[model samples]
Target: MAVEKFETSLKKLEEVVKKLEGGELSLEDSLKAFEEGVRQAAFCNKKLNEAEQRVEMLLKQKDGSFGKVPFRLDDE
Candidate 1:
């Protein structure tokens, strides 16, 4: 299967949320949209996890003098 970019999946998930919240779809259509939203959420989560792992790996000391440090947002 082909992977969607994180930004695309996130946008799709947001749209699904808006549709569900708007309460305009039939039960069947709502169910389908909910299912798609779940899928997009999972894909986005997976991509975020992969990125976090990469960041951790990159932060490790090059000369083996230090271990990997946890990543934190600068604003946090």
Candidate 2:
């Protein structure tokens, strides 16, 4: 099968954990799936971080020019 898109990968990761937590997959398969899901989730998170950085880079000041802006990935 083709590699899933970022959004699809994220959704699949969620589903994977939900299924594993529900006791639907065997021990071995659950471990394997959890590993794969973790990898996908990391990819999704990286993409999200990159996108957020891009948005911050596009922020314009009152002078009507774009420049790098400070953006916090963590709310805390």
- Structural similarity to truth (TM-score) of each candidate: 0.63, 0.57
lDDT of 1 by residue, 1-76 (tens): 2355888999999999999999999999999999999999999988877743445434547776767665678897
Model 2 worst lDDT window (10 residues)? 49-58
Model 2, range 1-76, lDDT digits (tens) per residue?
A: 2235777888888988888889978889989988988898898888766643233546778999887775666864
Mark the regions of model 2 whose C-alpha exceeds 4 Å error after superposition. 1-4, 52-76
TM-score of the candidate numbered 1?
0.63
Each candidate's lDDT (Cα)? 0.85, 0.78
Local error of candidate 1 at 8, Å? 0.3
Best by TM-score: 1
- Candidate 2, overall lDDT? 0.78
RMSD of each candidate?
7.3, 7.9
Model 1 spans with C-alpha error above 4 angstroms: 1-4, 52-76
